[model samples]
Target: MVRRRLGDAGPGGRGAGRSGGGYDEAQAQAGAVLRGERKPTNPLTAGQVHVAFKCHNGKHIKAESNEELRASSSVIKEPEKFEVEHSGSESIYLKSHTGKYLTVDKNGDVHASGVSASDGSVFQVLLQENGLVALRSHCGFVAAEANGRIRANRSLIGSWELFQVKDRSRRSRTEHPGHELPEPDEQDDAPAFFDAFCQVEGILTAEERYAKTHHDRTAVLFDKRVRSRRRDHMEWSFKHFYMEKEYPPSFRGCVSAWDITRVEMDADGESDTPKAEDTEDAVRPRTRSGSDGSQVVSFDGLEAGRCHWKKILQEDLTDAVRIIAAFGVPAASAADADEAAWQRLLAAQAGCKQKTAHVLVMCSSGLCKAIGPIGVDCSPWPPALDAVFAERFAGLGAGSIRLKFGALPGEAYDVDKDPVFLAWKRAAGPTARGEDWVLQHADSRLAEFEAARSDYERRRLSEQVSTAKKQLEMAREHGLPVILQLPAQDDAERCMAELLVAVFGEASQHPILLSGFNGRPKCAAAFLRSFPGMMVGFNGLLTHSKHKQSLGEVAFDVPLDRFVLESLGPQYPPADSAAGSARGSYSHPAHVLLVAEELARVKQRLPRDILRAAFSNTAKLFNLSI
Candidate 1:
């Protein structure tokens, strides 16, 4: 038994430690203030207070005379001012200037009623970092605004639970009590601004913390700052290059390199015909009449550095009947004039009306020519060499374009000297046909590359599937979501298909996400056909020229469950283009930041459910502590 001291009840009535004592004292003070028996001891000089809450839909909490609190967007001419009386401890009792006290009911509805500081009328004032205050009812629910009404409902503190309390009586700076203002600092404010920006953009919530967690095991390692830098660089690049055309919808899924020369040619060809003098410094052609009344032009280079002759010959000569190409010209006195003459000759050939023209473009690699159809004939070279050339010329035109393969009379196919050629030949096999190269050999080589990539994916998925299956088998496994990330390749699909077949019946019942196969619609469709229930996603940046053939077919063809914009690490090769290389390599930090910024923008544009589910799945996979 504890003895009560006289000081415990002196003046204040009961001990401060007692539970009901604070409420009784607060109630007496509130009653005194309401009855004009005592002056309110609140620090804030209030006549009319404007309370703004940080709800999903930003609106102000307003109180009408003798009515419940509600959120409103309209401006109140005469707002109700509360006589804020300080209660014992960190609590307060707000009495409306109209002789009514703000009280909460059993249902959490707040209304202006009697002046007695009952448990409903007493509120704990919680201060937040953003200079906002939270009002918590004695019933352990935070006073929050939801759907245009003020109610005490939230158990955890969040942006929605906070309110900005301002004293209207001291609205003007001159009339307000003097106080020292904090010094302005740009560096300190940047993080706050960034956090607010991220919150508003839905990339992060107010309660979410940013931690430097490694995401290497995921599709790509994303850095928020790097993403911002990438966005800035792209915008600058677009403006600097004066590129005005909108991105073709087909190109959006894959990372690609654009030929500035081809873009210039298209632009020029669309508006005006390029003149002979326009290309006088680039190419020179000496023409002679053929036996069949056709023109045969032998193109020569005067200067080595005058133009990218290889690019022009490779890209522009697709429509030509045959190409005789050569490289490495000996230093000559009249190199500039000779190059100018060569450009004039090529320009003449470009404007020529002859259909069966045989053009020779010389380079360092000696003279090479294409015979037969205007499109590339892959029959000359090995299947592997043809595949390489096809990738190089992918951006040139439409249809099944093949590269001219095999060696001419002077040139021998040197598989011993070139390691790349040797590897290609080994992969293509002897039976591989060059005529159906793009369909057969190229696809086969792509399959081989996929196989190599999938080896690791297969191992990883095998372990993950085994683990997930075991976890599902464990007791109380309900609501536990599992996500498996597989490389966007056929082997991955094959491996997944095999593994999933065993657990197909069990997997269909649980929440499981299948990521990294969204780049190809056919692949995604295949997975969906097999599983019919698994959620699928893709890494948007992984699809390159090797996958370009199927890119257009998948563009807007199938609806994706998720779209993940992943960052190819700093060492990832730039897209195959002169302009892309000139832009310089991306740093690791810049890569991550750019990816994060892009992810945010993508989130804003994509469907809400897909993004939400993707993020949830990612968090589950990475166990992100943030």
Candidate 2:
């Protein structure tokens, strides 16, 4: 019902909202495209626009090849901070100083420099991640998707990150090309991939969310699930918890403190669009797809600060009503025709003691305007329903918060498309062992491992893996149950061919739990024969795409105490590491179970404690607590 007259209709074309004129396919595509050629979304940067632009003189330089001269010419203005031809500019943050970078708190990775800074500087990349192989494939699902036009404007929205891993005082080695390997002492942190994934499969998005211009492993957008009713409506959901009563005016200003719950994209068109694999349908530009798409293409902290970051991006407003029903709500827009109906919609939630989850739905166009630098509403919840909060079940506790949109086929939010496979590929492109010279290929690498059911593989160097076990023994000497990060299946499988017990000699008497890429035929049985009951029965399936961006990988196969918080959150202390955070103290399953047991005695009346005990028991029994 609103208007956004800005650019064209076609991909990479122009215009913003529909001009009251009818829809045209060609205009949509052309309008979607930007003024010139666009950059292909790539991994590495933490989602700061990573562009290598040419100056007005039409001269372009390769920062990678010519470091010195490239540093001089790279001092261009930040596009996000660009000014009009004659407009006054503001001097902020050292005028885009060199060596300045965006470091995603989630991971300790450091991308090179921004296009505005010198070539050697470090900066976050500002590009959409939907189509990229590495970023998209990292997690078990796609957390962010593009929006806008079928042609160009497709973008993303999330925390932009930047950092460099060069020798920085604390470490003696360089950062790139095998200089900094995993430390033998630290382990226990899971890779900071995406935190939690969207459960919806096959929903369409007018707007998509990105992690960073690149990848940050805080959480996965989804696990894997087939759709029972994916045909009904394509949609996604994300939740962000804000401090009750007081929050910064906008997230842009306080983004560093906020935890992004989940980002998922419904690649389909409208919610009602039939689920089909036609990639052409997904080709629409992100902006035109609606605010969801726009945010995906262009991540914004400033805009989210200005407005309250509330949006509903479904093309047909009715989609909101249908999707909210999952939470037992029903209403569309704050209209006058149905006051009673509105109350029914707002009051229709179950009264469960578990914390209520808050969700925001956006129609494509609505979300676009919400983030635009123009006029729009900027509140957490719609003003019209201000009176409805006191009595609603979903609004009871301020714990869970999320944003979602209708999805289309190939929507990253869709559960039908394998989340693990899709996310892993996006985050760590071609992780398959041998495809087109890529370190990992999708076919042989992924499928072969998935077939293995989650087993560990040891590549001949038992010294490193064996040393990790020794550390576990050291921790056990201290009465701490150790967490051993079994290497991704391949790393463990290499040792199978060895005839000498000298390699895995530690397993000669004590067997460890069989996990990670365990689908290798009889892999667990072989270990049982060698070690006898030494193996724990936990499903330790980890994707090959993992580990590269996660601390979990570095800690894998090593004792948990060896894990360190080198990256972002979801970090746990290795069983033997010096305790700093509560999470670190309770990193291992044995410690967690012990803590829960202690709580069971102290917190005798709390109902959730029983649940906690159940969880603790299972986690310790399987060694899959992470």
Candidate 3:
């Protein structure tokens, strides 16, 4: 049986009586003293707040406000875990201020929200959304916890300069200059709220998806390897958009495994019927990602981990190593050299003294290949190079120097004992790659903001239509339907009502591709309202961790299978730029496989199905779960 042990305290001191004298009785006595039974003292060192009088009858009273008493506890509580319901536009403002855990109903004080009081304070939870869990300290996310910070991940903490490449020689031919890529063009007229963002993100994600589907073969072959080995050692290096996601410059998030599920439906291959016409096969149940390498597949059900992997790295290597070890996993290597370097790293971690605990150097096949070939004990990677480099530095009586490597691969192989290097050894997980991680959410007056944008869009669209119809000498196309397709995975429905306006749509008719917020000054809602009675939109799904993929992403409670169907309606897809035959399209396994593998590894290390559920809730609130 699973051992359910309470951590010292329970609600109102309910469980403590099991040990020794009743802790409840002691607390009642303490409460009496707190109430005013005993004599008052100056103050007791509880935490920060002062405790005054010690009354008789065991009541230990503290003269703090009733509010403080209501919230007081020895442990710190997280506010994000608190679930509030959104009945509608009317209910978002109606969140209960009582913050009570139970409601008086036919169920007899059943769970009001998912949150339950624990240890007088702390709230152990499963996430219900993706935004910052605003706390007294600052804003942060639970995903940051894996990186040695139990606290929240700070919002947009770093400046652009922090990402400057240190060495020019080590740069990849594809992205050596590290120049800025042009943000997608935004129309002067844009929509409001997430509507505009959805349009913009939809275009971008569609473009990227096109690259994957069309250019995948080319991207796989001649995939320029990002990191290289110099002479007898490894050279850890990278540049923007280098060979792949695992290269230090990757925009991927900090993902964990077990966050994606892989299913197998009946329609993966052609039917056995030899004479069947229109021989289209049925769709199969698979993981979120479609890889050329079929052997490394997993059927677990994690879907929202894509949000985690694409998250930035907060902690450095040393702390990262500690976190890996905490989960009983070994250190991940950049290349084969990491295997031998593991011993040196272990010794160094122990101050170069006799090593106590043994650590295994695990690396993915993608990463191993990056460091070139490997023998029984020799290679030219960071870990292997570090061992030699450390020795060289020590021999020269130089000061201690830290060896840094770029993004580490997501795979691992135990270079020590029983030889372990199987397919997807540590792969098979969900990931959140390709999305912005920082954005200041407009708070406090969100409702007002929504109202303002809607009004603005209405007036603007009315004028545009009035003027356009006069100029073209065309009659107002009354009762015409307008379609604004959000990215494929994005919920265009919520923002649909907001963007229904007649304008020069795609094909000059039918469904129009309303240019969403492509870094444009105008908002999406206002742009839509400018053209009153008209249906205009194109379909394209902005694929990413849904949260930071702009407002174009939609949310659904169902898995990827069901969520994808909504995008198939009348919508304009992104133009594929990487389309062609599968010849020169093939790239080396460098950035291509490395990225997928890294994404896979990162995905494999996270919590799966639960994360997706939380992601859905967030989508609903953001108006993306249409």
Expressed as tens digits, the lDDT of each residue in 1-626 for candidate 1 is: 00112112233222234564343344464456556565433333233342223332323455665477665532222343455776756677777645677888887778877667777898887754434567788655554443467778678886557665534333544554596444323222111000000001111110111112233422132234323323443211212111222211111111111111111122122212223342333334333322122233323211111222334334331121112221111111011112333332233233233222222222222222110000001112223223644444322110001012111112222222222344455699997554453444555544433332233233332334343233233211223333344444444445445544555442353434453333344455444444444454333232345543343233223233433323222233223211113223221111222233223332323333333444443333222322
The lDDT values for all models are: 0.35, 0.23, 0.21
Best of the candidates, lDDT: 1
User: What's the CA RMSD for each of the models?
Assistant: 27.8, 30.8, 32.2
Query: Which residue window of length 10 is worst by lDDT in model 1?
Result: 192-201
Model 2 residue 18 CA deviation in Å:
66
Model 3 agreement with the true structure over 102-147: per-residue lDDT tens digits: 2222212112232434222222222112111121111221121211
Off by over 4 Å in 1: 1-102, 111-119, 127-132, 143-150, 153-160, 170-393, 396-626
Question: Residue 599 in candidate 2 has what lDDT?
Answer: 26
Better of 1 and 3 by lDDT: 1
lDDT of 2 at 4: 14
Off by over 4 Å in 3: 1-296, 303-626
Model 3: lDDT equals: 0.21
Question: Per-candidate TM vs. native?
Answer: 0.23, 0.18, 0.16
- Model 2: lDDT of residue 541: 16
Over 1-626, each residue of candidate 2 has an lDDT whose tens digit, in order, gives: 00011111132112113364222432243334433244433333222223332221112212222121121121222321211111112111111123333111222222223344332222223333222221111111111111100011112332111111111112336645568754321111111111111111111121123221223331123111112112222322222111111111211110001111112223321132322551322432222122212232212221122112222222232221211111110011111112332222222221222222222232222121100000011112322212332232122110111111112211222221232434454676665432332334434433322222111111112123333333233323322222222333432333331311433343443223232222232333243334432322221111112221121211222222111111011123222112212221212111222222222222222323432333333234223222
